[model samples]
Target: MASATNTKIVSSPLLVLLLFSLYTSSAEETGTTLTSSTEEKNVFVLDNYGARGDGEHDDTQALAKAWNAACSSSRPASSLLVPKGNTYLLKPVTLSGPCKSSITFNVKGTLLAPPSRSDWTQDTIRHWIMFQGVSDLTVTGGGTVDGNGEIWWKNSCKTNEALPCTEAPTALTFHQCDNLKVDNLRILNSQQIHLSVEDCANVRVSRLSITAPGTSPNTDGIHVTRSTDVQVRDCAIKTGDDCLSIEDGTRNLHVTKVVCGPGHGISIGSLGDDDSRAEVSGVTIDSVQLYGTTNGARIKTWQGGSGYAKDIVFQNIVMDNVQNPIIIDQSYCDSAKPCEDQESSAVEISNIVFKNIRGTTASKDAIKLSCSQNAPCSDIALENIELKLEGGDGDPESTCQNAKWRKSGNVVPSPCKGSN
Candidate 1:
């Protein structure tokens, strides 16, 4: 959900595929300019006339009008634009794209969501703004998409709830989508996931501030599932739970240049329980910063589940005031004791590597590995991981056990042998 942008690299893998028609300005990209003076561009301005965020107000109609007007014949090329203005209160809105036409939401104003769940109707039970089957889509600009999450995060309805807390209240959700780019936006505060891109391929998220308070329940920054070829880079995150989480059916993912705090840093999965029908593989994370977080980098799996995680790497990370910098918890659940005992792990963690991570810790141990006794984590390598904990005597009780851990002794990542 976040990233930082340096000068664009000259030739990337997808340059040929990039039409270059979207941004027509020549090389010299200077300071911020309001309008892109190129052809085939659409523009829409949101003023206080119709769009207003008056507490319990619903500005859904105004937003829809703007979207419809932007997509109308004036911008027939489907160049959806966003003009600058103050935050316009709005209900959940859907921004979808067709296969042939690429859409750009040049965020100009903050899109504030409603404060009350009862303000929304039941039929509208999806993300705050759901994007589905979008192709070659780009969401960029210097504005924010504030979910107004304080009220809803603590009340999200789970499957086992008596009365549903709220339904489909994510900040932004994409399902079964392809070729999306989310850049330079502040996507924060959500009932559930801040931004979710599921079942999509070839997606990139950069230069964003995706966050929620650490006490907020289920306020994950970015949750990707059943997806491939995804990259999240160059952003700061402060959230309730996992800053970045990759679930099942995910492969070939990369994360870099991130700053995290007050949350679980980067996580693989609590994979299992038939919740998802896939596995995660071929992931790499580098140049990250973790602060005041629950766990720095983690790979979690259910106690009794199925699947396999392979070919992952974590490199060049900075830790500050974090509890557990490196962790792999194959036994994951909210309950105190293990519930169901399956034959083997529905998901097996293997072939992973951690490289060049340095930082300080506030907890007793720096790293903890807790894989299943039956299906152990294997073929793992941790090289050049330096850690320091200020108050500890270094030799603490066992908090890590199952997985294989090996690394340079500068800052030892403790094994998962002890309980909290």
Candidate 2:
């Protein structure tokens, strides 16, 4: 997929190889470890810290004590292990650190959240398990994190109109943690967002399986905001909201080799909301497969805001029966009340590239770019795109408004004006 060129397309195998080399080079240069290892790490077992390991008993105190000891240890590399073959119930807890050294929080057993909001006695229950201010941390083990969120879902206003809307707790959060690695974990049935990384740098999340029911409300698989130099690779996500949501103040984010379905596809923003400035740049999402999703490769922003979202690329993507396979909605409004028509200003969107995208769309509108009049989108390039209606008589259609774009190769139902 060459920009501004009519050259023949490269084969898939060669493209994948080149991408792999680039990823590896970046990994090496940044010193981001892709895997978690327990060897050479001093072990601190939870059972030794007075935890009963019973499903009904509260293990929050024991976990706190264990974390304190681990953080205070003089060892260079420490490990906090929750042994396998048991289920431990945890209340809302925050594990903060400016720890002694590098640490690995290994979860080999099932960590179950409180079943309902009534079980939470904290002042506020916005986050179930939060790790804050830690550096050089790795959380991995082939275990399960069960949010037990059915009761919350049933009471959510999004699910039932009778209930007033309220906030639900995210399952896991990493705030201000640098050099973090999270891999080989199963996160299931979260109340809201499954995992969030906020205000962090140099993070790598890979080989994770995150899932929730298709009808569950607001269960985004991974949400990254105010972070930089992050890489997400080799994950499978099925949730109600975006599989990967990249938010404001994020730069140098790369996502590759992900499988997403039964959810909103990979998205950048819903940014610049409430008349605020938002900045996001240098994002590359490549080699992803989406099936039965609401939207694929989307960039959305609210009106009446400032700043810019630019230098993004979505390449080598395949979609199966997806709706809105490629879209840029600059006037996004998720409120229950209708937004006023035609705002004056918006987030400036520029330098977007979509390449090697072949898909079957469930909706008739395969590509929709609805940009703002005041701050129109610019430098949008579409290359080697071929999208068809999944089960219809005619080819899928496209609509473009207030976007300056160009097409190089094989775009079906071309969206740009004067596109051949």
Judging by TM-score against the true structure, name the best candidate.
2
Q: Per-residue lDDT of 308-384 in model 2, one digit per residue for the tens?
A: 99999998888888998999999999888887664688999999998888868998889888898888899999888
Give the runs in model 1 whose Cα sits over 4 Å from its true position.
1-41, 46-57, 69-77, 154-168, 274-277, 335-338, 392-400, 405-420
- Give per-residue CA lDDT, model 1, range 1-420, as digits (tens): 111122122222123113221222222123223344433244454332266544345667776776555544344345444444556677777855453455666775577887878766777755788877667677777667888877775565433355465454778888877888888777878777889989899999877777787887778888888999999986667888889988888889999777777787788887885434448898998777777888887888776677788999987777776777777877677543456665365477888877666666777657777767787778777666667774555642225455665544333544344432
TM-score of 1: 0.81
Listed in order, each prediction's TM-score against the native is 0.81, 0.90
lDDT of 2: 0.86
- Global fold similarity of model 2 (TM-score): 0.90
What's the number of clashes in each of the models? 22, 0
Error of 1 at 285 (Å): 0.9
